[model samples]
Target: MTQQKAVLRSDGFTFKQFFVAHDRCAMKVGTDGVLLGAWAPVADAKRVLDIGTGSGLIALMLAQRTGESVAVDAVELDEQAAVQAQENAAASPWASRISVYRDDIRHWTQRCEHRYSLIVSNPPYFTPGSDCATPARASARSTTDLTHDMLLNCAESLITEDGYFCVVLPTTAGDRLLTLALQHGWHLRFRTDIADNDRRPPNRVLLALSPHPGEEFLDRMTIRGPDQRYSEAHCSLTRDFYLFR
Candidate 1:
């Protein structure tokens, strides 16, 4: 849980398998990011790509999840965030398997030569009228930096025929993504609606899109238990990485 704090490192957060330094990032590590990272399928992943890899969290997670031969390519546009992501990757146990790029995903997608077996992104989701103050935060929150069409088109072309592109979005913003993916010939093969607890409604949606349209698998995840502690499912999903879990 991003809501849960790590053993306070001087400049980073500690996990059971890795450490992340996000103070230089506009967007610090959050639950949505961590959840998307852990939940993204890596069953048979060979080469993976992580777009908008803030603090290199998801890329590192994939490195930790994949077989020893798998290599992870992560892209970040933010200069400071990219550097921090690079540093984080270098310090991790899977340092040699992860590479951090300091470039915009839109541009990076153009130059990227590798076709990934799995692609995951946690892009900016704030719609047109949000009260964001700083440029970094705005870049992290607003969609101006990376559009749905740009991400989908690139993913459609770069992903393997059997590959899947997964993303985490706000519940409301997911509608546009669903529509966009269909328009681009990608299908929503799986989705998970996430909520804080069993009582409250979902606020986030995790989507998995693929070139081949198949039966849509829908599911739900609650982060906390009735007693307000971490849920069994949440803990189990993240048990491999989180120390407290």
Candidate 2:
């Protein structure tokens, strides 16, 4: 498939993102990727994998945090996205440490030789019966692209015995994912519920899972206060990467 190049402009950065110039993929680089990129755990990680690495945002962020020695791989099913992810990685400072694979996660897992110390994803969570305006959006948002059971199975197979699997998802879908993880013997290690503001209910959940037994560390994070400004905690959490601070 021919790849079409595009550009994305945010407050702090201008990025060239590639797509099938004319294809259907519901998601583009958005706030969700930024949040997951900035919030995922990476300390002392030797090997990491970014599943469904749409824009290579999370992999680049990991590169920024980890040393040059770490190895990072990203998997993308969309051909255009895979190309774009490679372009993004090449343009970043951590280019030498990151590689992009244009393939399905299920197939990639079968041939992967080494286990990753960290596995992270911002997965498609919208389940069946949800409202979707277009085929692209449905593909990007719905579990039809990658089911929860499949994600769990892949994580169980790809992650090392002590590795951590981190993900961000809508709170509604997160509940089902947590239940499935338990059934598969993947223990929940940490979780944070995120709200747009203090007055609103949580819309997203960030979670870390592992095979080792441990109690869950649960917390809540509100992005904004009543003043409609970023909360101190939010700023602190993302200050390292975000230009707002």
Candidate 3:
């Protein structure tokens, strides 16, 4: 187990077909990114866009899911992280189908030529005024740099008429994000509340929204069971990404 940790440490984390390097990025790989990458409906998607793609983890996961024919593009505002994202994608088996850019989504939406079938973001949702040692960490976690309005406007401009936008957020921010999404002509298409255990309140919400309203799909997921092992549902959702799961 110690040796296994060392290997994972060297490679960041190993996925079925790719490895993500997050040492230089402010945000390391986490469950939120994995859940959003897998839960998103990408089977029919031809062009996918990932915003704020720190470490390129979620984008790489999506690239694996979408296949070689589908094009996946990601944008990261942090320059160092963007470079790391580009490198990660370049090293992946699906390298030819993935592209990473060092640009802000707000600006990218203005001139984006390709219409995306799906757009995703595990956005920074925390409000300002918290203490964080690193500027990058604070920027990644707090909305002082990125607001829900910015993300929604970019999605509205870049997504196809029938396309979907997916995201995962802490429950507090997720509700507010959903409210904002509704105001801007985006409606919930699917939703799943995520809890660590069956007994605990949901800490995160995975959401998918489309331009047209439909019979909203809803579900709940518990990450761990009574035995303190991964719940079956959680394992199934992430089996493709986690090594030796």
Candidate 4:
């Protein structure tokens, strides 16, 4: 039998419907972005916003999940990453539905007149003084630039009355965000605690909040089962976008 070899590259990631080239991005493709993209509620979303759209992964995913009538606007602060996101969106099947803007979310909110039905972000959660390997990574990880309060305020300004604001964060940061959101008059609609394995406590949390109050929905998910394989829940949740699911 003839033998063949496959070469792997680190510059980009391939999803089921689109490719995200992140070589220029400080934060490369990661589970948090994918989870938020796949897990965020998108039904009947006429317009969607993706904050801090590095590599444009979530924006592209939202474009794929949404119908022709839906429009997705993505904002990124980093110049190189914004260009990369734009290129990725242009290459995707839903190019017309996605718009990439190289601007801070804070400024974008001021200029944007239209309200979005849904807004999502895999935001920087690391506190200042957190150890990081690079300045770019530090900017992408640390909250020194984008505080939770600022994020919530921006969402409040841009979201429709009944719109949903969703984010994925570390458990501790997520808990703080919950409190902050409530203080800002936003009500929690859904929460999902995420863990690496069945035996460990959840290390991450997915939160969906809105201005309108509703009965809170809570759930838990583990990325890996006891067998050390991808859990069924994880697979099922990401099956639509993950190439291997």
Q: How many clashing pairs per prediction, in order?
A: 0, 0, 0, 0
Q: Candidate 4's residue-wise lDDT over 1-245, tens digit each?
A: 10000111488887778788999999988889989999999986989999999999999988888899999999999899999999999999999889999998998889999999999999999999899998888998999889999999999999998999999999999999999999999999999999999789999999999999989999999998897778899999888877645
**Predicted candidate 3: what Cα RMSD to the true structure?**
1.8
Which has the higher lDDT value, candidate number 3 or candidate number 4? 4
**For residue 146, what is the lDDT in candidate 4?**
95
- Residues 176-204 of candidate 1: C-alpha lDDT, one tens digit per residue: 88898898888888899999999999999
Residue 156 lDDT, candidate 1, scale 0-100: 78
Model 1 has an lDDT value of 0.87
Worst 10 residues of 1 by lDDT: 1-10
Judging by lDDT, tell me the better candidate of 2 and 3: 3
Candidate 2 lDDT over 25-77, as tens digits, reads: 34665667767777777885889999988777778887777887899999988
For residue 165, give model 2's deviation from the true position in Å.
0.4
Give the poorly placed runs of model 1, Cα more than 4 Å off: 1-3, 6-10
Q: Could you tell me the TM-score of candidate 4?
A: 0.96
Ten-residue region with minimum lDDT total, candidate 4: 1-10
| Sort by lDDT, top down from the best | 4, 3, 1, 2
Report the error of model 3 at residue 211, Å. 0.4
Model 3: weakest 10-residue lDDT segment is 2-11
C-alpha TM-score for every candidate: 0.95, 0.88, 0.96, 0.96
